[model samples]
Target: MESLPEETSSSSSTTTSGGGVGCGGAGEKLPIRPPIQPPSEKYSPLDWSAYFDQESDVFIPESENVFHVYTAGKEGPVVFCLHGGGYSGLSFALAARKIKQEARIVAMDLRGHGKSSTENDLDLSIERLCGDVLAVIKTMHGDSPPAILLVGHSMGGAVAVHVAAKKVLPSLAGLIVVDVVEGTAMASLMHMQKLLSNRMQYFPSIEKAIEWSVKGGTLRNIDSARISIPSTVKYDDSKKCYVHRARLMETEQYWRGWYEGLSEKFLSSPVPKILLLAGTDRLDRALTIGQMQGKFQMVLVRHTGHAIQEDVPDEFAITVLNFISRNRIGPNGVEIPGLRRPMQSQQ
Candidate 1:
């Protein structure tokens, strides 16, 4: 489901930490000194507070479910973000910094991920996820909800389409799906188990996990990995290391359900939409045809993997700001300068 991890290079320089005895002014014979090994680079875990302005748990009334959320910006349209499988809300941390200036952001850790607590945490059904989003939004904003633009990446993209198709959010103003296509996602499901197996099962520390996520191709940006990967793992007392927070292997039953009919649902949703991809090759028959007819805006961001937002957060944020500005979909409804107009829709 993701591109092969990009190779990273490191260099080591030998340094003498200890001084060896040599020929002094007394003309003593020089002694042989053993070689000194260079120290390994150290990776450190970053705090979420550095990127996001706030973090809170939205407790659903009359239920044990408590969804963890991160937010920034005080005004403008609310961009509700959903992260991919195995990722937490912090996945959007880097992008939030650039997005907050133009609009508000609300990123949530879906059930079974991060600090979220739910009765049946393993239930990743599309329907269950949709309901969770609606419930949380209602609890957070109530009847007078602010204008909302739903943004999702990978598996979260599929969920976003389904949620928008339901047409429940009266204030829903826009949709932006990042690096996910129905055809590609469905086809990739067969190899998903193998991909999951290849990942390191445990790490000695959160820093190591972050390091692996960057070098292993799961994430391309180390800064993004630093802020995001920590939330995706928990300290395992039994193994004495950090392990994945979500049990992805147990939710195999819901994999297909997440992506099936994604294209049709996304195309049918009546709203201004944008599809952002790492490469145009990901476009399927439906999306390709739809793009030809100007059904939705398609943007290609080169040199990125599946985690487009995390891989190139600054660019991702600008694309989003341009989308919002082009459609005039924010609370202030102001157009951003230099952004092109939306493509003409086919009648």
Candidate 2:
């Protein structure tokens, strides 16, 4: 895999290339471009690389998959973040910045996503994905096992449930699943299939690609799209164009049985879990608060869509930090002092 560009400080100004009506000089102002909408905030210099550290590579033996991992903070309980389908580890850039101060944040691109290798033709099953996650947890812990908190979104949430069900991580602490529920997953999957079916496979310029990404989906936050699009697309020197890092067809294949029987596995697991939903309207009426009362905590993030972390990152980070800090589980299967589950609400 090609090495990512070196990291730059948050104060640095990064220029956009590919000149056109929408593209301009470093300080030039332009009209809002369709598809790739300009960010809501005042246009300042933007640099996506400043959000996280340089990427580190990891190879998972169980899945025979090589992953691109991005980490922050040097010490604290391990917090592993898994991104949703068609998204990379960089999707957690904003959340990582906030959570790293409290915990060791480790986010990775799952097999066939981001800079990770998809050439192995490995089965993208939930079991294999869970194994990949377990490998990373063990590798991070080294000789002695340490408590780990797993946070996942969308398809990633399903993967986290499988991992929790396996109960392989003796030091596993808790779980936070974002914007995905077993009851609503099939509908979400159908929507994703329709969207990917019509998505552009290749673009002649990076600006066009970015524009397409911003306007294509339910994403309302242009700033988040700007940060996310760059990492998801790469310039192909051979083809003289930019293409998605992961093929749309391959991503769709993985969704075949992604949510089947996940709710049962998630609720039955003994691990402490939190289900963070983006919108209550999209939630399955069948899965009520009563059912999840003791099994898992459910919180609703209002006014946001599927990408809860991106749309409302500060709240997302704070919620996770509060959840982890309050519900900390020690290695001896005992709750740490000052740890208590936060009251759930539909805020």
Candidate 3:
């Protein structure tokens, strides 16, 4: 129900919250995702908007999903980043800039969220969601120097995992998945996404509405157990209501088949990788940091939730950087940590 921005060439497209074309039927063009580069001689502007330009697109030949890409560290390999729920590629601006300033980090807002436009096509399937990321890989075909590192948080983290499973990414040095617990089963997550969406629905007119969100905080019943995040709010005096900076459909689509067989997908990844998760969110921390199984390494961060990257950017960035710096199968493989039960394992 939101208006679509004017369409552009796959590489020229800008960011959007919903329907944007990608390599798949999603519409945006996609390029093969390259690897991270070394540091640059000088720093590029780290400020979100200033650092990013609507430059060359990474399009997928199959679908039209376009990820508005901004590059940094023209010197090193590439780091392909996927953002969390409702956040655009800009969410990584601060941390990406601070982390090894010269590294070329590419951040993208996946479909139905951030700057991607999901107007023409509706792909609520996890496979389709991953196709958007695939668009980036197909475009690069291997121009990178160092290696490609995939980092994703929450939904984006899921996308990173889906792609890492495929052997196509040989340059994939490592993977970093934030705040997600695998094997919980998709149906349970779908229900939770629905409950949260129902709670955050915006009113037709904020002026006539009893409550509205603000920059520092959101309007809500103090007693409500639900959690919230901080965001910049804009109130149009003419309209007499508050408009959230995030896209509406993004809020609604969180559970729309986000995990269509995701468990199976993780088990199917081509290589074992690293996982970073939150200790707070019951869902994220449900499983203990398991033993590293030569294929997978897991780390735990306390005091965070589903959106750990935004809640604590510096720590999140460091965790991911650390993983990429050490992308390898240890002699002992991965040492799975002890579990904090009622948590389950992949048996």
Candidate with maximal TM-score: 1
> Which TM-score value belongs to model 3?
0.60
**lDDT (tens digit, per residue) of candidate 1 on 151-212:** 99988898899998887777788899999999999999999999888889999888888888
In model 3, which regions exceed 4 Å deviation?
A: 1-47, 50-65, 100-102, 118-121, 140-146, 184-187, 203-257, 260-264, 267-272, 280-295, 328-347
Q: lDDT order of candidates, best first?
A: 1, 2, 3
**TM-score, candidate number 2:** 0.76
Select the stronger candidate by TM-score from 1 and 3. Answer: 1
Cα lDDT of model 3 by residue, 97-153, tens digit: 555453567777566554455443345456676766766665754332236677887
> Of the candidates numbered 1 and 3, which has the greater lDDT value?
1
* Model 2 agreement with the true structure over 1-347: per-residue lDDT tens digits: 12323334442233356553445656465665234223333222245457665678876565556778888866677678898877888788887788878777788888777887744534677777887787776665653455678889988988987887776666667888898887778766778767676778888866666656656653545567667766777889998998887665665666756788777877776767788986676456445653546667888888776888887888998998898767755333344222333234478
Candidates in order, TM-scores: namely 0.85, 0.76, 0.60
Clashes of each: 1, 1, 72
From the highest TM-score down, the ranking of the candidates is 1, 2, 3
